[model samples]
Target chain A: MIEVFFQYDFLRYSLFTGLLIGLLAPLIGVFIVVRRLSLMADALSHITLTGIAFSLLLGRHINFFAGMNPVYMGMIFAVSGSVMIEKLRHTYRFYKELAIPIILSAGIGIGVVFISLADGFTTDLFSYLFGSVVAISRTDFIVVLLLTSVVAILLFLFYKELFFLSFDEEQAVISGIPRRSLHLMFIVIVAVVIGLSMQIVGILLVSALMTLPVAAAMRLAGSFKQMFLYAVIIGEVSVLSGLFTAFHMDLAPGGMIVVINVVILLFVLAFTSKK
Target chain B: MQTNNPSHILEMDNVHFSYAHQPVLEDINMKVSPGSFLGLVGPNGSGKSTLMKLLLGLLTADRGDVKLFGEPVKSFKQWSKVGFVSQKANSFNSGFPATVFEVVSMGMYGKVGLFRFLKKHHKQKVREAIAQVGMEEYMYQNIGKLSGGQQQRVFIARALVSEPDLLILDEPTVGVDAQSVTNFYEMLKELNVHKGITLILVTHDIGAMSDYVTDVACLNKCIHFHGNKETFEANREEMMTAMYGHDVSVIEHNHAHDHHDHSHDHDDLAGTRS
Candidate 1:
């Protein structure tokens, strides 16, 4: 396995990006789970799918855009979708979560149209939808790296603000924490993570990568710091083990990683129940 | 009554608020003098929470001026001197994985600002706040594992850690047990008296809170009565009339009321107040 990882640059790229996503997803996921906005991630990922489909459709028709990475377009849609979610939630304050389904349906609707117009589902689209280990190119790895750096800096700078908001939103507002700006920044970060992570975890299963580790950590962690530590550890372990299994068995890494996360969540639930 | 006093920490004049054209608060005028414990009692839909939100700048009043620390709320940048604990403080996620210290430290986040880490003094202040609420032993305990009363105390500590001059709590004792509610009131009293912290508490248990607060304001979409607790107790019939919009019987609990007897007293008061 070690020899295979060293022999294949694609394998190295997949493992490296997976490790970073494993760390970054749950780091953001802690806030998502704590704020009860887990489904917002699913909504954003679907929106990314639309952007990918749109980019693919454009790639086939336009010579200038033929070789462009769909991931860039996906990020644009994800970020805009996040802003739209914020706007819709503001517009319909009483039914805030309604923003999720509205975006989700629009994403699916537009994505289907784009896919059909792009001459049906191809292997490239399949890689974007269900994830392919070899689908991650050198540029994709660089994009993930840049995103991971941005996320790290923002998290470091705004850790307390994010934590404060997640723990008690009303208090955060009353304390004059620039709640609107910080909230917008947070969801955008969530959007970016969702967009970049789908390259490895697949659009369908990205939220699991973001949430499952945090869910497990919530059961065992005694403090917020411990929760982060436990979540990242769980995420890394799941991804590494999943990738190893997928490589050995020649299965899809996205499904394998998510299944591992589910097993971990079940194990934590069963074990923690005794306490 | 002391509307012209510059010492008022919180002032709302002719404040009118509504939701979708239905008036929630109408012609409301209120003032909080420094170092006074003001208990705001009102029935459901009486706009107690809305009024607090207006003061906290969480909601914009449809009409009128809201001044905090002598500045209009829009420009009231000295938020470190004001702390708030909502009614849902005790109703937050029970499984939220945060330690008591972490929860308390959140109080300083606003004052500490962004991009900077908490200093040692800030951590010490968090410790002091936890100790102030008598939760030092649970500083490392998960906040979710604590009882509702303890969680309420942690929230109070969170509010106090900032050392705010004006502390606003909205129905803070909703889910707390009877025994702890008494202690909660005592803690508020100590904070008010010793720290000179102006307090505005919104609650439904007027009878229980009436015994602890220095001033009382009875409301039902309007300020029916605003006076000292003694005056409020003396004019119970009129205050009850103002609270419920009709002649209502009010049970005034004597000083000898014990924890077990509170239910009887509360029931009698709830019957009238609601």
Candidate 2:
């Protein structure tokens, strides 16, 4: 692993970025898991793909024609899509589950449209669908860093509110936690995290990164704080090891990271599960 | 009835609520004075729980007003000041990582507000609250690991942690062991007497309510009766007759009346120890 890190600047960036995501991903993953919104993470991640493909299609157009970073546009689109899912879910009370499929299909629909419209920009959609850790650019790293900060800061600032809400939503409501606002903000934060993570873990397995560690941790932890600690430890180790092996074997790091999480999940399930 | 009796903590005026236009509560009216233990009792589907929701603003009243501390319940900003324990005390995030202490700490969220974390005093409050419910032994235990009785106590502890002016508990003793139910009411009585916190307990067991509550309100989609404990005992036959919809449990009521035989004795019921 040290050798891999010392070998190439890209590898170093891969490990650095991977380590940071390992910490932040699972930290947020704990909240996502507790709130039972792990599936929403998957839906939002895929939605981000449409935004990413559009960014790819219009990178040159953005720089020369539009005078904007495609990343910024992509972020806006991804965040907006996340916000839309929240609105749709909330606005349609009787059809709460409908939001996921609607967002999922809309994303795929937009991706298909953008792919057709892009003409010749990055035809290898499989890479984005799955994951390629090496695909993370310097700009992508910056975005991930900013995203990690946003997630960490917001999570810290709203720690009590989110914890109370996630544990017992009705109690939180009775306590006047501004359920509507925090709920909207939660979806947006999830979108931002999913957007950045899609580059490495890919849309396909990003939710796994968000869910598996927390599930495993629940078996061992006695309280919310302990569960978070356990999840962070599990998540960080899995991603760092996966990133290293993926680099050495010349494979996609994101897929490897998720596979690593699944394998550990299985290990924990076998040992800890009562049934 | 007591020295700690302050102004009314809750006042409901012609409160009417329904689900999908099917009436669950009809023209309900009640008031819970501070430092009093009021039991909202009725059979199943009698809207005891619904009345609690209306008081907490958890459910909207379609045709009346629920005021908290003389203000509209909807406009109550200091919600944590009125603690709540829904009937489904165990129906929370069972898999979430949180101890009895943490769950109780969350009860302070309203008073602590956003951006402000729990300070040392908050920790002390949590510690005191958990101990108040006789759950200090399980302070660090995961809430999911506790039995039904223990879980209910933890919820009570969570409610108490807020140091509320009023505590509203809906069927909180359900699913708990018999001993726990007795213990829980005793704790509530202590809080109402010693700490001077108003407690509104919603339960189907009017008999159990008689054990501790200072006042009683019977409901069957509406208030069958609402007044002081002496009035409840004085009208025991009516409460029994009204609740059973004829007369089946009259023996138990007679037994209690005969056993206490102190309806007019004032101090006997008021100072009865659990």
Candidate 3:
């Protein structure tokens, strides 16, 4: 683990990026989970797959200008796709499952078209699909860092209002918190975190990182502050352990991290529920 | 009943609102002075909370105007001038994790800003609000661990943390224990007598109105009765008959008014600087 930390800068960058994601993913996850928007995060992450594929299919061109960092295009598509999802969910009179079909089919449709066009499905596209330790570029590292700072600063500045809204949007608004502004801010933050974390954890595994630590922490912490602290700590531990295990086993870092989170959750639930 | 003073804290002029073309509240013309405790009594879905929502600028009125402290409600930017504790439906009980102190301190969000980096003065104000609500013992305890009444008290503390001229509580006593209900009213009465904060108490508790509320407004999709405590005391039968529209029952539990003479030091928020 120490050797993995010291020998290569990419791994160091990966570790730092992982830690940043560790704190933020779960922090935002608390809102998604509370607002009963848990599935929206899932839908949003899968939508990132479309962007990931497009960045790669058009990878030969976009990367010609800015290197192989897929995040810029990834974020653009993620935010746009999320906006679409919002529109679909809001506009359609059908069930929320209807929005899922629209977003899911659109994401999968775009992803399939891009992947088939790229002709790099099995071998070259594994980084975007699974997780790639080698793909954590310096630019990706910087993007992750910038995104982490933005998410953290937003959360800190709006902690009380966010808490009130997450707990009770109706009451928070009645107390004069800007309802539309706060809700939009939360959605944008969720998109940014999911997009950046996709480089390391893959879109498939990121929401688990975002949500699991919070679920586990809620069972143990006596207050909301402690829950937040414990969630960050647990997120850090999962990311670090997963990165180290992936290095040793020659496995994908995202899968390893999610596994570590699941193990931690199981242990915590068993311990706390026993008490 | 001489209407001499033009210094009403809250006023609604012919307010009209509807949901999907169905009228909910129409022509709500009421004026409340500073330091008066007006209780909104109504059956379920009678627009009690909706009127409070209008007061706080949550729901826009379809027509008419809402004025806060003589200024238009829409024009009042700094919400700290009006403290509000919404109904208990907003409370987080299933998976809530907040200490009483943290939850109460959240009330100061408007005044102290969103961040928790409070100065000493802000800290003292938070503590004072918590103590005012008789929640000092559980200040450090997790809010989810407390009883329903204790949680409501924490919310009241939070609302008061900003210390506005008008404090609006939407059914603050419902679902709480009987002992806590009386205790909650006592605390409210103390705040009214000492701080002279204009209060709007929305509840269904008919018997407890005289003890805490200076005025009562019974709502049944419309204003069945809007008048003073003395009038309610005088026309109990008529008011109940109008409220229920039939042979409505009233278990006249006597609530003493003698305990409202307590003293304290407060003008409540910055708007009531007298």
Q: Which candidate is the best by lDDT?
A: 1
* Candidate 3 Cα errors over 4 Å, as ranges: A60-66, A92-101, B1-6, B89-91, B114-116, B250-274
RMSD of each: 4.8, 3.4, 4.8
The model with the greater DockQ, 1 or 3, is 1
Candidate 2 CAPRI grade: medium
Better of 1 and 2 by lDDT: 1
The C-alpha local distance difference test score for the whole of candidate 1 amounts to 0.87
- Flag clash pairs in model 3: A224-B97, B163-B269
Query: DockQ for each of the predicted structures, in order?
Result: 0.74, 0.78, 0.45
| Top model number, TM-score | 1
Model 2 CA lDDT for position A96? 87
Q: State candidate 3's TM-score.
A: 0.90
Q: After superposition, how far is residue A8 of candidate 3 from its true place, in Å?
A: 2.9
User: Which one wins by lDDT: 2 or 3?
Assistant: 2
Q: Which candidate number would show the highest DockQ if scored against the true structure?
A: 2
Query: Per-residue error at A19 for model 3, in Å?
Result: 2.9
By descending DockQ, how would the candidates be arranged? 2, 1, 3
Cα displacement (angstroms), candidate 2, residue A233, comes to 1.5
Candidate 1, A128-191: lDDT as tens digits: 7767677777788988999899998999899999999988888898887888899899999999
- Encode model 3's per-residue lDDT on B87-201: one tens digit a residue: 7654565567777887777677666654456678888999998998888999888877778888888888888888888898887877888888888888887788788878888
Pairs that collide, model 2? A223-B97, A223-B98, A224-B97, A224-B98
